[model samples]
Target chain A: MLNLNNLLLQVIRLLLTFVIIFLTLIIFGVSPFDVFESILYGSLGSYSKFIRTLIVWTPLCLSALALIYTFSAGMWNIGIEGQIIMGAVGATFVARSFLGDDLISPYLQILMAMFFGGFWGLICAILKIKGKVHEIFSGLGLDFVASGIVIYLIIGPWKRAGIASTSGTDIFHKASWVPTVGDSNFPIFLIILVLFLYIFSLIIFRYTSLGIRLKATGINTFATNRFNFSSEKYIVFSFLIAGAIAGIAGFSQSSGAYHKLVPSVSGGFGFLSILIVLICSRNIYFTFIVSFLFAALIVGGSQLQIKLGLDHSLIGIIQATFVLSWLVLQKIEIEKITYKQISKMFAK
Target chain B: MILLENTLVTVISLSTPLIIAVIGETISEKGGVINLSAEGTIMICALFGFIGAYETDFAVVGFLCAMVLGAGISFFISYCDINLRMDQIAVGFVLTILCINLSNFLGQDYVRINGPLITKFSIPFLSDIPFFGSVLFNHSLITYLSIVLIPLSWLFLNKTSYGLAIRASGENPSSASSRGINVKRMRLLSCVMGGSLLGLAGASFSLYTKYGWSEGHTTNYGWIVLAIVIFGGWNPFRAAVGAYSFGLLQVLAIKAQSVTLALSQILPLLPFPLMIFILIFIQYINRDEIKNVPKWIVAILGGNQPQSLGKKLPEEIK
Candidate 1:
């Protein structure tokens, strides 16, 4: 669905955006050039940094992909954080069990994580469907509840031997880690899973009847009744699918990144993925590209504190501005206007 | 008795910020807007409120500045919803993230810095009214104002004509416009008013209740306020009760901290789960599933979510 013409327009717009960012940085009394240079160097400078970006990208892209399911089905799915947490809990369960030292533990963790995350999501769906609660409220409530459960498990049942702490259970056994490629730690397992899911999703949305129905349900819930499909069922289906995908994101975080469960197992990436999904506007292709760029931004944001003597939060401010501008510019029809201007030049 | 009295007093005093914020949110919701940016709005306002007081040496100035910023933020959200035809929840959610990080970024220098404190002031005659006076009157000026706002805002929402218009706009904007009301302006106005009150609530946290500025000074309190507004069922008076109950929970949580590492952390989050139940109950009542639910039960607990809350104003209305 994407073409080179629109891509060129986006680049032109990106240049204009950089100018605004440059001015904002100046107003904050920082050297914009230095800030940009450091971010570039930090994320892409070394082989290790590039590997780190891939690690962040795996879970992030997974979450964004998961969000697309619900977004297409027209639900906010804010309980995504809880789903991610539950997935980690599921993985941790396998990591700490009798199977802890076995190579097959990672595979078991994947299934358990999917079930746990899917069930948590199912709870939100049931609340909204049967109990008449809005998804946002139920989702928000479930998010806190899930986090509370994680904290309880960390400090209560799953605490490290001898002394309990919130830093997280001791790092899991190496057998449970996402199988990496070599010394460079390429995380081949996670990258493969991400690619497989993205391809699966693109096919689901493009060629499948179920995907078409989900979009139909999203666009107009009442209208779906005319087609004899239950919108509520699709809502449930979407949450379950989204939650399961988000759970895989949790697996990626646990096995691919930390390799253990922590109180903050989700690491706020679920919410960041929401921001990514917003900018992508449910476009699956854009979601991948945007998620990768954002992962780099986050990986790079650490450099702000170490090298530039700046707060890492500047990354958030920049991203938020990008979303706000994206939403507003979309309303302004920037693409159409750009397309028109370029066409006029070509005709002349 | 003394321990209970003291706890009650502390609950009234500490709940000051929450009560003000809940009332603010109730007003916005009543006018058919969610102001879902409560979390971020309160966060940034708390930072600015502390900074304003720190720079000027007057807590009042800090509050005023916070109110303006709060109003400004709400106005921006409403503009997107009403004018740009965007989703209210999406904009508010984005703003929450933006303001939260913005506050942390801007507030980096002010973290743990000392600022002016809001002082206690008992009403001249009210303080002598035995148990009631001690529990409600003898507290910071902001506390008294928050307590007073409960009844006043209730009257404003249920008694006054302007209140009716705002409620009408939220309840059914199309009907409201058909009746010659300006739904857009009403929403915008209420959003700004509520946003400013939210700002006040944020400032109160820094200057009065919690005291001083820090990164995420108000933190999850904003989400707590959003929950309370619903728990209160969108009524200022009931919402105040909900806010105070949360304050009581906080106090108990602090006391329970000595008992276990996990209990304290979990107690304060009690409201979110409870809010979900309350929301479900409200729906159950709407469906008339339980015929025996008393009228007061519906009135007090909540059967009153604005029909149009968190939705865009219809294009036809514009």
Candidate 2:
């Protein structure tokens, strides 16, 4: 019965979030129903486009799941964005440097890319734990640095011999790229990646000692310290895990969708991961759903602008509003609890 | 002579936002609130300031409107964090993201529109002084206000009754409450006031410097200001000195670009290292000083009130 009540409250919160989003869209002169339809039709309207949307959302879902692990440790790892970029940089360097090697297997190359991405995230984690710098600002600063590196690489070493605004390295060898899973290779890999991230996150979050320690640290570091756990170590570990996962996002976007490393390869997937984690309230399972919906919105929002002459950035405004409203609503919910437990039965 | 004048002008102009924001933030921090939302406040103010000045062609109106908007934004943060007792750092961070996107959305239309820039004003005799004349005396009223406000703020905090109340609240909320001070009200007002100054700083960027709006125009000034506040050890005069020093480095970067490109780019990163060093120094300094102060003084100035103060104080006083 208590479980049911909690479930109901969560559902109400989710519904409230949707309602708030709908109202905000109305203000922007876009009908919520139209948005809903567009998203639905855009994602599933054509088989190829649906597959494309699913493919695009794969790394995004993985990154969001990775974020849950870090967030559980009570660290707002804004550095995930930088970590993802670093991961991409890592993957791009690896692919470019050794793509023609005869001894390197395709699967091994992909694995190496994944490892490189994780390593980039670990760098951020180490900096956070060792340097005693707040991850938030450091992460933002690192993003600029990473983006700068990417820009430098493109204009310098990674520049294609002759192309206008190509601004990136040559395409990866076919073997280094992740082969499509089925007749529809893109959708199949997308499905596999999403399921893998969700299941892995679910198991890790529910069944691991590190996960529990992370959660404990997130809630109260002093209490966690009382148990003799090093919150800093857990935080560092959490950041590494988050970074590695975001790195996979970078790797997947390049290997699966773009097939070449570019400045826009991740296309703000790192940032979108924040919104997904927020709306899902840090639940791994719900994050999967939110990532897909968010992916659909990105796909549809652009379509709406192209077809109807609406501002594409309206999606950003809508997403920000939803997150902001949720923050306000979350505070109100907390205020209703704890101190004095203001009764709803009292006259309004 | 021209080079010196330009360098001085650049330093003062760039320093204005950081100086104002740092000074205001010093007040906010001394009141026990670490407002990471300073970035958001400045960004939103920058956007709104551009809109106001572009629409009205009046610099003061644009600045005033920006302050009002900044105060409103900061109020939400203070309301949530202070009154509701939510996590101060988390709320401020969230507001930072929200404010940035909100300003960016609104600023899309206003970006290209140019507003009248505030021309430099010279004090009669002060302007005639040899080296200092053009460097310090020849600037807009806002720049002059910064010059006065630093010392004025220092006086207010160290000498005034209200400053005492603010310091007391920061030290111990419960004891301050016991002394008939409204801790929440003080913090809220401090945040609002700080935010307004930050807004004025933002307006000065567009109205007095760039004379046009652009997305991300605040360009991390907010974070730099926060770093400046900490670097100054939450002291207004020290913060001004910090801001001016940082401003000089920034100006030198541009002026000496022909000398060293790498150094020019890396000069901006100088503050991050300095901020970390300063934070550790202050922590060490305060740790030693923590023991010698009277319990009441500590309570009034120490961050977060002790649990004992609430029950020990007279019922009527609370």
Task: State the local distance difference test value for candidate 1.
Answer: 0.89
Candidate 1 lDDT over A26-138, as tens digits, reads: 88888988888888888989999999999999889999999999999989988999999999999999989999899998899999899899998999988989997888888
Runs of candidate 2 with Cα error greater than 4 angstroms are: A1-6, A28-30, A39-44, A100-133, A137-141, A144-178, A181-191, A253-268, A333-348, B171-180, B245-318
**Quick one: best lDDT, which candidate?**
1
Summarize candidate 2's per-residue lDDT along B4-48 as a digit string, tens digits: 887877788778777888888887777767677888888888888
Highest DockQ against the true fold, candidate: 1
Clashing pairs in 2: B168-B300, B171-B301, B171-B302, B172-B299
lDDT of 2: 0.72
Once superposed on the true structure, which residue ranges of model 1 sit more than 4 Å away at CA?
Answer: A1-16, A333-348, B294-296
Q: Write the per-residue lDDT of candidate 1 for residues B43-159, one digit (tens) a residue.
A: 999999999999999999999989999999999988988888898898998899999989989998898878888778988799899988888778888888998899999999899
- Residue B209's lDDT within candidate 1 is 87
DockQ, per-model, please?
0.82, 0.22
**By TM-score, who's the top model here?**
1
